[model samples]
Target: MTQRTNVVVIGGGQAGLAAGYHLRRLGIEHVILDAQAAPGGAWQHTWDSLRLFSPAQYSSLPGRLMPSQEGELYPDAAHVVGYLADYEKRYELPVQRGVRVSAVHRDGAQLRVEGDADDWRARAVVSSTGTWTRPFIPAVSGRREFTGRQLHTVQYQAPAEFTGQRVVVVGGGNSGAHIAADLAHAGVDLTWVTQRPPRYLADDIDGRALFDVATARRRALEAGHTDTGGVASLGDIVAIPPVRAARDAGLLRAKPMFTRLTTTGVEWADGTRADVDAVIWCTGFRPALAPFASLRLRATWGHIATAGTRALDEPRLHLLGYGDWTGPAPATLIGVGRRPARETARQIRELLA
Candidate 1:
């Protein structure tokens, strides 16, 4: 049986939930299809110690503020999971769990979202599958041959297994820095590697500041000004408490990326080498656009080309939470709710009318 909705949201994470909120308020019937078995989305898979860059009050959805975790200045991953679960229930969003969408294609004037156990045809489709599942590791020489254990951010949990072991953490982003700090705090022999020198945001800066900077940058670009690089100009890594402490203690110091992986460990361009027991690749991810493969809508940067949130190639589709390409700070919790969701829903309503 084909399930029909006015709008079909192809992910039930933060982005999809936010879209559902606005679509409901606009009286547009919609269903959110989620691949995860339960709530929390990507937060369910994050390391146990992972902390938000800002306080709970600053990291909220459209209608509700995330409740502060007792005794926590910046909430942990578990707290985020709880918040997402509660948010879904509070909003009564129509989310169907464990529905892994395989493809989205045109069917007459409507778009069809085909999933493992169900099908949804709708006048509009919002694809919000964020990048957690599609992690990227650079193609360094001998990576496959490295005798040491290797894992990506998705596979990592607590730092128990790596304690006291020689570990190399790759990538300069927040994930890389956080994981490196976790390992270092555990007394591991840790080497942090990045393509360039790791840039740290000021101690006073947080997610709220980053969001403001990003908003300014977007507005400037829209007004025909040169790109100012926004939050990037400040730094790549946010100085969260643990990361800050680790950096102050010299535990989070980063080295230049190694030239290649070796059988035992890694070798640098110079005669330098390190024998590490494990290499954790915090290398980041590509947008999870595989389900939209039928549409061939991705641009050169691997995201759908869009005007605001609507796809250029397929006007029936809107993309949310992928990144700035979708909207300013669209990938963040506050950003997803503030801009993309509301705008996308309004556009859908206009189109249907």
Candidate 2:
């Protein structure tokens, strides 16, 4: 027999938890289904050296502030993990871990969420599945022929494993910069590669600045004005302490994109080749919307077409914390909790009413 709920939130990451918090506050009965066996969501999978670009005080979800770490201005992955775990308990969120939702389909007027061992019929389905599982590694010719190890950001751990080896880290994003810096200090001959020149935000800029810029852009667009440059125009990479230090010390220089992967390393179109031990793909990820395939809601960009959080194609479906498409900075811990989660819950409450 399928259990019944007012709402069923898939993927108990920050997005899912935020959805739960608001739903409960509005007196909406909901259940959050998380695939992981523990809390921390994607934080559990991040590399040990991963640090938030924002300070603990600035990186909080609604209803609670993330306590400051005694010594660290920017908290590490483990600290965030602890905060998320504690947040789950403090709010008394109804999260069922280890329940990987396989599919969501229409069942009469309700949506049917099928898990491994159980099924739920919810009035509405909130898909908060962020993109940690679907890591994207661009296809370069001869990738299969490469002999050395190749891994994505999700697979990366500590830098000790690559010690004494020549390694190439690909992509221009924060992950690329961070990994290259990490590997550079770990005794590896490290090379960072980017398709375009890496853009670095000012040393003062952090997650708070990014959000404010995004907000300004949205406001400008809404007021029928030209683009105010937004976050993209400012820069892609935030100049965190380690990354900035690495850049200042000349450790984080990035090379141009290679045309293809050779047996040993990458080769440029100009026939320039670099021999390396491993290639770490710091490429980004796509939305984890495989379970929602039956709903036929995703657009050409592999994201659900949404008017606010509501899916344009499926009204009962709301997508949260995927990225800018869902809501303003909804992917961030503060972003999701600040507006999207509350707005989504309010919309759901209205729908139920």
Candidate 3:
């Protein structure tokens, strides 16, 4: 007999885990299917030295508190992964690891999910894969010609691994700023290249959180409106303390946007070239919706198109963790994620009923 569930959650990271936790609490029968051998999706592969900018209070899952105190800076990647593992144990969430979902299709009133081994039938499907699956590297010419080691931020682990190398970090986002600073401190010659000078804000600016601006901008864009284009320019949002410190140290410089990749290094739009030993593309990520390509997508640029979490056409297919669905306060931290998950779960429950 084919395995069946009330709901099937794809991607067993924080989002999927949260969905499972809520479903169980509501007495909804569900199973979580994760691609990786373990939980903590991108965190499992994040750089070792990285720490959460959000405090511990903002990082907790639905029922359990993140094992830290209020106002304390959240733990590193390892700590987060450990916490996720513990969450799975605590809830005994029925997650099937190592099972990659190939596709999800609707069959009559049920959803059919094909995986590496077998197919699953569920009354409904919650795609909690989140936004970090596909890394966005702009199509720059001569990237393949670059002789230097080129890697995405998703692959970056630590500066110790790139010590003694001349590194060119591309993009001006949070990841790029952090990586450039870290590697430069580790005795590596570093240059950060961004198309536009980012507007840096203090982590707390004028008693208004920087993330609040980001969350607001994201929500605006998601609503088919644009607010100076999604927090790319730091001047619009508050800067984190570390970013301010980096700026004060003169370690961060805004360069032209990426133009092309050469074997020796990267070339910028201004025709400037850097012969880098390593190229760290801290560009950012795109949602992985390839599995659902058959479904009509409401999109702008490459991101999914939805009015808030509800799909424009298909209300059953909801998207969470989008750039601005929760307005300014809830979009930037894990804490904000809970509200959306709760709302989405409620909607899913209603749909199933």
Q: Cα lDDT for residue 314, model 2?
A: 85
Output the number of the lDDT-best candidate: 1
lDDT scores in order: 0.91, 0.90, 0.72
TM-score of candidate 3 relative to the true fold:
0.86
lDDT of 2 at 276: 88
Provide the global lDDT of candidate 3 against the true structure: 0.72
Of 2 and 3, the candidate ranking higher by TM-score: 2
Candidate 2 local lDDT, 1-353, one digit each (tens): 57999999998888899999999999999999999999999999999899998999889999999999889999998999999999999999999989988999988999999999999998999999899999999888999999999999999998989988889899898888988888876768888899999999888999998888877777787789998878888888888888888899888888899899989988998999998899999999999998999977659789778888999888889999987877778889888998889999999998898
Name the lDDT value of residue 105 in candidate 2: 94
Give all TM-scores, in the order shown.
Answer: 0.98, 0.98, 0.86
| Model 2 misplaced regions, further than 4 Å | none
State the displacement of the C-alpha of residue 162, model 1, in Å, after optimal TM-score superposition: 0.8
